[model samples]
Target: MSAADPTRSHGPGGVHPIARLPEEWEAYFEANGERAFRGAQVFRWIHQRGELDPAKMSDLSKAWRVRLSEEGLAPPFELVEVFRSRDGTRKLLLELVDGGRVECVLIPMSKESDEDDESPATSGSSAEPPTDRRRKMTLCISTQLGCAMGCVFCASGQAGLVRGLGAAEIAAQVLEARRHLDDGEVLSNLVYMGMGEPLHHYDETARSIRLLSHGEGAGFGLRRITVSTVGLVPGIRRLGEDFGGKVGLALSLHAPSDDVRQKIIPMNSRFGVRDLVQSLREYPLPRRRRITIEYTLISGVNDQPAHARALANLLRPLSVKINLIPMNVIDASSLAAPSDEGVERFRDLLVQAGYSCFLRRRRGDDVAAACGQLALAERLVRPSASS
Candidate 1:
């Protein structure tokens, strides 16, 4: 089976050629009458070195190189454009093979007073080097071309879901983002928090994680990856079971009550908050790892003190850290974030209720890189390209 064949015929053991793990590659090589060690070598060459051109793989013989070339290795998408925010955030737009476009953002963890002051100071003078002070970057990637979950506040879901991305299309976003990293910076964390709800594409997302965290691949620690979902109960349970809860899970629990949630996040009508909380309780989280509860504070909506109290009460049974995001305004919606004073008051109520809570500082708002603000403008300007 030649790689150019669009059928994507699996190797001897049903491994997709491009997404094969090391052991699968070994099985393929053994089946193809080649040494098993060549599999590991090929895996490293493609993932570790990011060398997809089989002709550039110098370690293999001429005949083997020709065979591997037939079993192609290429990225499923291409980077189209990048919008850099004044605050050092970069929003990347990628075009898939079928002409579908998705957006991803790269956010650098800040070291200014806002972030540093939050951490308690040490007693003695710090001996850490200046290079250690460089902040780690988190790349937010998309699981689908567009979102199916019609969250009233998110721009990605405004048009409805286009299609789910393949595992290679998902992992390629990381490889493309890494090329734009600045000096003294390292890509540390990854959030499935851009463009689409990750749980909507569970199988492809799971395979992408394995490809990203494999020792021969991107090598990211499982702890460094966070998958955000809009309370997809079955997907949440499956993720916990598959990864043994080692991967970070972030729940988009925007409202305290089912009535309020259903209005903002339509998915709540399918899986209520009660069911979501039950799913969280069953997730086998590792010790000291807390599930992130993302509550977007919208003006005159879910930002009231009573709502905060209810949220705190609702989460009392589970181990969680609350991140209160003042919603970013979108052109498609008239909804807006609560006032600074109101947001602070809401956060205070949660804190007084004995829950660890934080008012998340909005990042990259100037360039439309904040939460729920991606893909809408691009979709408007490039409507023809999207089709």
Candidate 2:
């Protein structure tokens, strides 16, 4: 909000076509002396059909199409590379117009059906991706090139924040991901838990959500898109109010006690565990919707019988389900997931305490695409941390 700000997370000219809502696009066209409906047409082409190339928009007059091409309606990024895993997980490496890179992953999964599971989150892991045709693909998208929070165990934040992505760049990842889906796979849900603390750049993240959920554009159910954060309390409250508590909220509460959370999640030093749990009490979670608690079980660090019991006690008040992710191994990181037996014990403690818990299976590790493994800095760049 000041001249001293590093850089605002926004697209060129302050907004990109992919990021503009239908009305915003209509206004842009009206301001340009063109028919207002052209805005909706273009929006549908870009989001509803994943057509970003101006040349591909056949519905427009040839003259207008040429003008749009001249005005630059092409996609904002290029698909640099794709690494496909044996388990039907494809990791997309994208190069932005700024020369910064971000990775988005497509995991074709046999998720718990929407009718069967009432939670807003469509993310749940099975031993393998679906092969029998009853499947939905979850696209994990990034909000920044590198992370600022500097969590010790996460690769994304190991190097300090490089730059936050614009709303167009963030939402476009979903459109681009949809284009890459195989014939049998369908893109269903989205997760904002990719490369950065989404709430850190609140404006851009919120704008992207608005664009994605716009009925004429992507038209996604806000419930199907879960925005995961490391419990920035203010952001959590704003999300509940801004989205009417419809967009799913997942907390990366890796530990129940501040003493342990501080060691792993540096952001926890500012927002404590007790404060986070209390904030959810005010979160306008819809009926039958439960906030998801993501606990990363780092071996010998926070994985213990006592820790699990404390976690159950701490979260007993909130209507929540726990996802126990054995921390994914990353380059040069000595930390790791606990032994299988230890992971099972942690889940057992939560289950016995009458909370739903699931062990998240690691997908696409061979291609470095699992959780906490989306670090893509060719050379480390450390910017001064603000939060």
Candidate 3:
């Protein structure tokens, strides 16, 4: 039942590490000629301890470690590139079993005036090291190889759809990140906003959520996770059906009207604002849970104060919060993020009209570490699907 049992019958190996449920741990051990009790101990080391190397597992017999290692039961990934931003942001480009690379980010929230020194943790530490200072940290992980939803403004879209990552691939990003933290520095938040639209890769994404939130995996509470999409109606509704309030939802509604939205976010044309709002009404949002509407303000395109008014009118009734993200510059080059004053004015209009609003500050712009930039570089270097 140990978490490290590769033969565990959780589900098909769809890329994620701990996609299978914890209950299946015992079954995996029994089949492996080990006592059922070994399952819990192994699972704890992998999940609770965040241990990757089998040799470091002191609780398990030496024979089991050799067996596991010889069988190549370790996580199927290698960190190929680590790009650090001046603003305490670290983006890791990981190469998968097939030699394709995906990007994952670790954004540290710190009040320190200077950037913290860079030090990647060793495999021996499964537990996150504690930091000297207290600051909220969030991990951004990818769910798919490349996105099918070709949002005109997003770099992840230009690469086209390659394939969806399995549950283990997605979970491994978080598990790998745990090694870098100081003690007591558990991940405060997780966002499916890295490269792919999570809703398009639904089942594996959902399974990954269950694994991360499960007590035997990352043990992150559901509230700490956030799934973002460019308005995939079917997936949005499915969240309500399956996860209910276990995780948070963020909708990428870049425009208040279909006309402007379709130009940037094509998915809006299929699921218009009306359908999106209607779906939200039916979503099983948790108590005090307000869905976040992500609006990336593009200069002179959708940044007009009038658009803000229209947005306020559109969302007046829904229990929602507005996250005004200024557009991050990328090669697509068709749009520009709104100025600070323009973003502030838009927020003022929302607040004056009785809506909660917050401006998402620009981070890692120098390193292209902002929202949709890393995916662009990764796409260029990642082997084509045919390769």
Candidate 4:
């Protein structure tokens, strides 16, 4: 996390289709003894334009297109189980080519009547025209198979850590999401708030950020993406220096006090709140972007008025925005989500203290796909971390 690169490979098994745009295209052209220019064309067709079929690429010669077909370049990650909420939230369970599955979600923003406009984001470009009424859809992506930082409240960490995903695998999640949009509807924002503690996967997460913002590739501006962490201090410092002005960082500061935090988050012992907040306070932030402090308010645990005061005191020095998330029910617990009134009380306390605060509403809870509920079923199929 201290600008030290993570140990990586072509990834275990073979090259994942989503993670290997460069290698696969290069390999294809090399095997056919074709000009290198073919790689660029095919890359644009797939990543930039979001074109699936090779035949759909009109710019490529018919023979080359036929060769592409014969090579069988198909989209990776098959759609298996899809869950739709009546409220317009959709959860997609995708089966990777190797038979492993991961979840991706699409949360539609509420659009007003006359402002119902949508446009496809160019493959590598994250540019979207402004609309007074367009809903901001956020795509949550995963960085690792399972999380290493096992926060007790999260189902995703229940299975423990699997392995980190490569940069391509991370970027592929965004690419795959684009396919489901109805032609012109653009994915407005992206969050690494999915399953894993992103900063722990250090190298790939940073590399994925570069790929997403690369104008010739995925092209999502760093400003539009936020990487969430469960208090990995080294990662916070590294990201501040390396990705300083590009991307936003969100810390999962669930509990304000160490005594309470350690019980809920095991990582707290290693990276305590004092150290974590100090790093966050010192981390260079972009002009308009403030670091988001995500706090999950548990009913009888950390939702008290005293807890709010402690939290406000903890974040006083830094440029921070607090996102209060009610403890939505997790399959492993008996904790009821804090009542609407409880959430309001916490928000009002932070606001009166002159801090920016917002409540994160739980979505797709019926399918166990809401916040704190994205535990993929593959946890049973995959091997243990030590294995």
Task: Name the top TM-score candidate.
Answer: 2
Per-model TM-score, in order, reads 0.88, 0.89, 0.86, 0.82
Q: lDDT for model 4, on a 0 to 1 scale?
A: 0.70
Q: Assess each prediction's global lDDT (C-alpha) against the native.
A: 0.78, 0.78, 0.73, 0.70
Worst 10 residues of 3 by lDDT: 113-122
- Runs in model 3 deviating more than 4 A are 1-17, 70-72, 109-133, 182-185, 383-387
lDDT of 4 by residue, 43-130 (tens): 7666666665778999888987765555434555567766777766777776654554567787765332112123423322344345
The true-versus-predicted C-alpha distance at residue 230 of model 2, in Å, is 0.7
Decoy 3 TM-score against native: 0.86
Tens-place lDDT digits, model 2, residues 1-387: 111111233334435566777887789889889989988988888777778777878988888777766655666678888889988899888777656678889876545323323322221223335544435778888888788898878888776688887787888888888767665455677889898889988898998888787777777789888899998999999999999999888999999799999998989878899899999999999998889899999999899999999999999889888889899866647888789999999999999999988888888877788643644534433335422
RMSD in Å for model 3: 5.3
Compared with the true structure, what per-residue lDDT tens digits does model 1 show for residues 20-111? 77898899889989999988898887666666767888998989888777665666667888889988998987777676777788887654
Report the C-alpha displacement of residue 47, candidate 1, in angstroms. 2.3
Cα lDDT of candidate 1 equals 0.78
Segments in model 1 whose C-alpha atoms lie over 4 Å from true places: 1-14, 110-131, 371-374, 380-387
Candidate 1 clashing pairs? none
